[model samples]
Target: MKIIAGVIIVISCSAMLKKDDVVRQAFDHAAKQTLVMLKEVAIKLQAAKAESKNPMPVAPRTLKDGDLVVVPSRDWTSGFFSGVLWYLYEYTGKKEWLDEAKKFTAAMEQEKWNGKTHDMGFKMYCSYGNGYRLTKDATYNDVLVQSAKTLSTRFRPITGVLRSWDHSRDKWSYPVIIDNMMNLELLFFATRSTGDSSFYKIAVSHAKTTMKNHYRADNSSYHVIEYDTLTGKVLKKNTHQGYAHESAWSRGQAWGLYGFTMCYRETKDKAFLEQAEKIAKYIFSHPHMPADLIPYWDYDAPGIPNEPRDVSAAAVIASGLYELSLYSPNAKDYRAKANTIVQNLSKNYASPVGGSKGFILLHSTGSKPANSEVDVPLSYADYYFLEALLRKDKLEKTSYKSIQ
Candidate 1:
């Protein structure tokens, strides 16, 4: 019996080693494909800047037909490509990636004071936030602090949540979308950097308010929750991107999961951690989630097998799970689920190595109901996919308790 037990232990250890090797290989492949695609993107963007009268391209958004669609710095998605470049720099420690990251990140500096929208974090933090983390440049610090202050302007004291849109007034009195949860990280960063507890307080208020209102009985999240600015009353629940008001939007759910996990990380709040875990359960245990762990644009979308898969959602969920694993008692399960997502994305969803205009992953649905950016390779998808890979690598080297 003792001899048999020893043999089983050896086999288990060998299997674990082999699994680690597979993950390492996946990382290597992703790094190679990313470098190849981004080099082409840089060349094309430079040529376009020289010929066009438009503002400088800050990031690649998606593919229109087969061509690259680059956005100016003011675009909400402008920071993701820069964030990707920073991830590449971190992974390869190459000066070329560092240079490209700095150039792209610099273009987003003008948005530090642009309070017209609530995407300050998506527009600035993803770029400059990651830049500061990697390089510690003092200028990046100023950009981030100012960006947080600008984002704070959208917070409605009565509503206890940041207003998500300024242009959709005709549709909602005070619109707050699940995507806004992602912006709270910038606020938390500001509090840490400046020692201004106001940022922290606002972030906590938003998180708590959303937790109370956004979730349904099954822990599924609504895409949009409209509020009455005068009374702090819940007006209505709506869906701008999902199939229906009550249906769970895949990416929105992903945002909620990532956001709460991040909140827990910053605050060590057990309620936030519990909320994140519940969201994770809702995602993985959904009847419509595909075998690959990628989900349809909406969990309740009518066509399940035929609907477009949102790789972007999968990327965000994978990244969030990696962080949640570090904090939750169910660390092993979360890690396994995240690994499955990374493996499937690296294997089945990637763009052709030298193709897709340099975007890394494919088949990301961006607001399908609007018939916009459907079945495309999105920049944010690539950003979170790279982030998930880095987080997975860290988990392999360190224990769960060692991370935080």
Candidate 2:
């Protein structure tokens, strides 16, 4: 009885910290974890180089078969590890993190000209975009602009969408996954960089088209939209990575929410803001949302407690909500929701010190429907989780000043 009372008191005290204090502690924990990750990755890179015949550099993706998995430049997730490093540099102002980030980012330079994939924004922009934003580096700006041009090539004027994949034509003639919404950030930056609105125009067109066709009545987005390339008609709405044809894939919703919120930020378009809010309402009001605010791999996934939780989705949504709160009239509610997500993730999903194979968060399901990356620590999860921490810190500072 005495021990139980002691535990209850500890829990009560932990729950009583101010939101800013919780965020500060989360950031400190994340900083230490990032340093450990950097060191582990460095060791893994050295081992991979020693074993590779070509000695090409690689970025860590996740743990596979009990070893750190490193992906080459062409992999879709290749840039996220570097992006995480950049955030760590921003958060900690540590020269070592910046130097390591530069090295990993430079390795992706050649991908700026690779137009075969729709992931140029993920491969180039996430690394160089953050790099340029943080350091004002002209070289990083050039890479980002070129990547935007390369990504633009994938956009079909007739379809009004960027082609997400080429080989799945039997599934879609010109496939445009909801995830492509994320790539618009590169194009928006290009317009600001080059004084050419072509990139901006394409970004807006894609967003408008996606807004028209991708969402269900509940505002939950489908995972993939197949278009007739010649006629600007949607061939099908499919859930390639979701549990069912009509199910809401958790990460897809996160991408849509983040992307539209970003669109509003770049253009200040009221329509985009409304769309973001609608999506947020759908997600937050959904019955499947766990009491902890973490969601299953799919909101409609058949299993509940037995199903994998998507920490990546939670991270992305938390980051998006923090940004959305700054712009929305319902700022307090959005910030409070975001605060809850960040606090829950920091306490529950975050890997213990020296655990998770040097990754930060765990239990992210990449594509459970496809039977890939189930219950693992993903690089993008860490990237967005760090982003949420930084945004929360920024919001706290802003609120403190307003109070003063």
Best by TM-score: 1
lDDT of 1 by residue, 373-402 (tens): 999999999999989888887787775554
Residue by residue across 225-335, what tens digits does model 2's lDDT show?
A: 888867989889998879998999999999999999999999999999999999999999999999999999999988877899999999999999989987888888988
- lDDT scores for all predictions? 0.90, 0.88
Number of the top-ranking candidate, with lDDT as the measure? 1
User: Residue-pair clashes per candidate, as listed?
Assistant: 0, 0
- How big is the positional error of residue 291 in model 1, measured in Å on the Cα after superposition? 1.5
Backbone clashes counted, model 1: 0
TM-score of each: 0.94, 0.92
Off by over 4 Å in 1: 1-20, 402-404
